[model samples]
Target: MLRYTLMRLGIFVGCLVVVWALVYSGVAPRGLGDSNGMWVVLLALLVSAPISFVVLRRERDRASERIVQRVDRMKSGLEASRNQEDAVVDGTTGAPGRTS
Candidate 1:
């Protein structure tokens, strides 16, 4: 996840630099007034989104797989705990100490 995030941030920063350069050189239109910086940032975000989506597809998939594995592990742990509690409550266990 961190790797994907850093890559995305890198792309955004790259786009921001390119857009800023374009606006500075008068190649790209600037904002109406003092909003030039905001315009550049927004434009960069817009441009970087698609680029990041395409470039970071593999990274994103790997990050998602990691997340899913974590969630599955957590779910399995919860289910096991629940089963232990049920067994104790139903008197299936030979000796019962504490539920917690």
Candidate 2:
């Protein structure tokens, strides 16, 4: 998970730097005054999304697989516990406990 997050952050930063350079060099339209930084950030996010999606495909799929396995493990454990409880109930009920 941490790896995935860091990868995404790296992509966003890369996009930001590239876009900032383009605007700084006058290749892209410059934002006026106050909104300049915000514009760069928004544009970075927009550009980073597709780039990250493509670049991080393997990591993303690995993370998804890990999450699914964890869920399956938890579900199996819960089912096993329920089955044990049911068995105990059936055993006790079938042969009632006797106190001497």
Please name the candidate that would achieve the greatest TM-score relative to the true structure. Answer: 1
lDDT of 2 by residue, 1-100 (tens): 7899999999999999999998789888777778988888888999999999999999999999999999999999999998788778778799564332
Q: List the residue pairs that clash in candidate 2.
A: none
TM-score of each: 0.90, 0.81
lDDT of every predicted structure (CA atoms): 0.94, 0.90
Worst 10 residues of 1 by lDDT: 91-100
Write model 1 residue lDDT over 46-91, tens digit each, in one string.
9999999999999999999999999999999999999887776667
Model 2 regions more than 4 Å off? 95-100
Model 2 deviation from native, Cα RMSD in Å = 5.3
Pairs of residues at least 3 apart in sequence or in different chains that clash in candidate 1: none
